[model samples]
Target: MERSHDGYDLFSPEFRADPNAHWAAMRQAGCPVAHSDKWGGSFMPVAYDDIRDIARDGARFSSRAIEVAGPLEAAGGLYLPPLTSDPPEHKPHRGVLMPYFLPARIAEFEPFVREKARKLAEELAERGGGDVVTDFAQHLTIAVLTKMLGVPPGEQFTDWMIRMIRVGPKDQAVRAEAIHEILGYLGGLLDEREVEPRDDLISYLAAADIEGEPLSRKHKIGAAFLVLIAGADTTWSAISASLWHLALHEEDRKRLVADPSLLDTTSEEFLRVYAPVSVARLATQDVELHGRSVAAGERVLLAFGAANRDPEVFEEPDKIMIDRKRNRHLTFGSGEHRCLGSNLARLELRITLEEWLRVMPDFRLVDPDGVTWSGGQTRGPERVDFEVVR
Candidate 1:
């Protein structure tokens, strides 16, 4: 509140390291409509109700700016399909994309998830020392997404994905370049899918229908683009953060390693604790929230993580309770815009923890102070060195 800046800097190192403290301070500051000029003058709603209110009212908040728009918006530029579209229009695109992510459909991929996690865990166990982020999280996520899309793996895809996700939030020029490259690559892949169709998301999108005709090229690209960008960073971050917690908390680790069945509840607890997503929106009309006025066309950063940590919502919200019951955290945003990848993400986290504990029953951080974490758009352990006893 004392800062010269218009609003809080979400990308600040201090905030990223201890966002809950900042959120608590913001709540204490008693101004829910905190303003910032970083994203062209945005407002961040700190309270859980305020965040969800902005998310749920599609009529009042537009999602056009949920993603980068400065450079990514141009003639035939990337349109983020269901997510970027609002209300009535949001329905059809979301409709076309939803079936693939349904719980039943995601269930079909569980075996694949377990196998990939198992193979990766075994490799990491053999090595007995590795960074969870690069060694395990990256491979499992990239492989899972690639398999789901029915596409071959390439260094460019994964490497640029990491760059685009991490850098895009900080450097617009680099972000634009990354977007251009990805769009071009996805365009080429669409060409390949044309002739050599396979039983995967790519092929399905190629032939997907809406309103009695095949999907438009833009729709195809957007849908595939959504899957890549959404699935890649988010899942990997959640998985890596969970591992980091386990490496530090032995009692919780021992409980889970002892009873793998606890993973069902444990996975939800991890999501509540290490939830890794922050969505943005533009106000469609002036609105009063938590006793503050947000003007029309204003940008709003919905800090779901903050809402998840609201003391009113969760007792000792800062503490990670592996067996915590009745946690209604909004790790996933509220309303129709809730993350479509939730089912897949949960499966990946559960399976990764299962396989890791099964293979390396005991492990600890090589250097507690040496663990590096990523911040900004998504948060997770960028690198975690574990000394494992296999």
Candidate 2:
């Protein structure tokens, strides 16, 4: 039952409005490798097993071409070290930075995460209503990153982060420009650390010993750049999406408002339902996947959102189960290339949802018809409008 359509258009208004529906259609059509040139010829695997296997099997499916094009190649495009690099090289690079994102390490930052969320939540409460994405998610995203990465909350840095996250890689030139700006910003911080060390990510990366030597300036910039872009972008979608879910589902929101402890379960449920990222990988060699011949060098988009919804893996996959059992959806990815900052992401989401409910528990989306999602790579409401009475 191949799709009657030629291929999936990621940027199609229909797809952008509802990727889940697109994925469902693709899956139903029994098409696993739907290639599209919309973003420079990429193949998307819409099944749970295929996505999981491709992500973990880095040897066969190289992450060196994470995107269909070389938009951000200078900073380390597809070969974004650690993430873009395959094993042996990947392990050491990822290992050097693992200590910083360890569960215990991220857990220690709960107070900072909560305080940031609380402040933004209180302000939103005081205002009596506003765009959750702008008023709440954006501020908290920047705040958490600034504190965690040890970057100063400077206006320029904040502005860059917001722009990079909000306006991510729509055009090649703009994306390349954003990469340069991030490198320049982080490069300056690195130079400062060289003269006078500080207890921050830049300082650590510039000074830390990897494989008995400090990471080269280039590697430092690459690792830092990955974090800067990844940190500022992904989790905010999850945060806004959580609120979006609660906004529409009163039963779910009321349950959480009644007992905030359900946050851990509820957060996971929201993450599963609205997984934010759909990272791509380049095939290392010719391979057969789901009856299709995938030639080497082709980009494979791992539809994380689609994988989470596969009925094969989840019972009643479409509905929200706040307390889903044995839940192991790949929201943070899988294997060695799994998201480095997942622990922090979870904490941000949990704390953000908590603060939102505490302050604006009864908030609802002003108009479902007016909602629209941002579509290049990550997905979430571009502007989550809430009906709040000031």
Candidate 3:
């Protein structure tokens, strides 16, 4: 099979393990727009400025069409809410969803989030060691999202979400089956909510009126799935990558421990260094960028991982500075399509790291070589084993 125009093979273990080298090579080659037949019509942007420009100007580079072109679109079909829509239409959907994730509402979730993190940490501490990615990061995200969605904390929701959002080759049939199961469950939950509307996000959406009419069943389900998947998988990836970095760089970990005030800045550095999701957007109109001409309707991948490491933007782009000031990384993306749950993600990450460092200050990766990397839209360590050293 021919590799993508940018010479990236998505399935290649090397690419999965480390994409920075390939990104650097492409940027050196003059920020060219490279095509990939594998992704149907997607192109990779190699320069930092080009990606930032494209992301900021949604008029020319729309997110609507791109949401349908890639694997995510194929998986769940064309019913994604805000993540797959553009401005005028995007506004109301975002409006309906935003309140549930508002800073104040998220504050309400902090105690619950912290307790869950502490509980997970306690379990890991009991084991004295565990695969942080699978045991801790994955389950912590699942618990948080399920609780937020008003689903009873249980293995069913967690297992289903983990499987449903797992990135692989696009399988329309399997995806459709999963979607049907999820919607069926959500429909029943909505019915129950209607009978007795609770304060949960689903109930809020159920009662939300758009243009004077309540959100339809489809909108409810779509919005719920969008929030659930985004909230669960992406946050887990970010948390996992942050832990992985700390495990590898003991000195940086020590620095963070010395000055816990560095948590927020350290989180940003982690997002820059380990951008979990390599999100893509479709160009709605033809535009020339960084000497490369991209055609209208072509897929433009905003390589956040690459952009974060661009030499023109950040000095020592490869190094993870715990107290990195002047850092304006686009890991949460930019413009109207920026992540609504970013505040929540940051909160969760802060709590997770703070609690972990406090509980197991000297923990270390048990078998670094045994760790594996996973890829798709998001990238991170698949299995990271660690031991508590207290």
Across residues 289-328, which tens digit of lDDT does each residue of candidate 2 receive?
A: 8777778877788979889999999999998888776578
TM-score of each: 0.94, 0.94, 0.92
* CA shift of 12, model 2, Å: 2.0
Question: Which candidate model has the greater lDDT, 1 or 2?
Answer: 1
Q: Candidate 2 regions off by >4 Å?
A: 1-5, 68-79, 154-168
lDDT of 3 at 147: 78
Q: For residue 126, what is the lDDT in candidate 1?
A: 83
**Over the stretch 225-262, how does candidate 1's per-residue lDDT look in tens digits?**
99999888888899988988899999999999888878
Q: In candidate 3, which residue ranges exceed 4 Å CA deviation?
A: 1-5, 65-76, 290-293
Error of 2 at 115 (Å): 1.0
Best-to-worst lDDT order: 1, 2, 3
Residue-by-residue lDDT tens digits, candidate 3, 1-390:
122346456547887788887777666665456666564557777667777787778688777643322453342244668887777788888888888878998899899889988988888888898888778887888878877888876666555554554532344455556667878888898889988988687888788888898888888888888887787767888898899888888998898899999999998888888887766677777877655667876677887888889888999998888888978887888778788999989998999999888877778888877777766567778788899887
Error of 2 at 256 (Å): 1.0
Among all windows of 10 consecutive residues in model 1, the one with the lowest summed lDDT is 68-77
Candidate 1 versus the native: TM-score? 0.94
- Residue 364, model 2: lDDT of 75
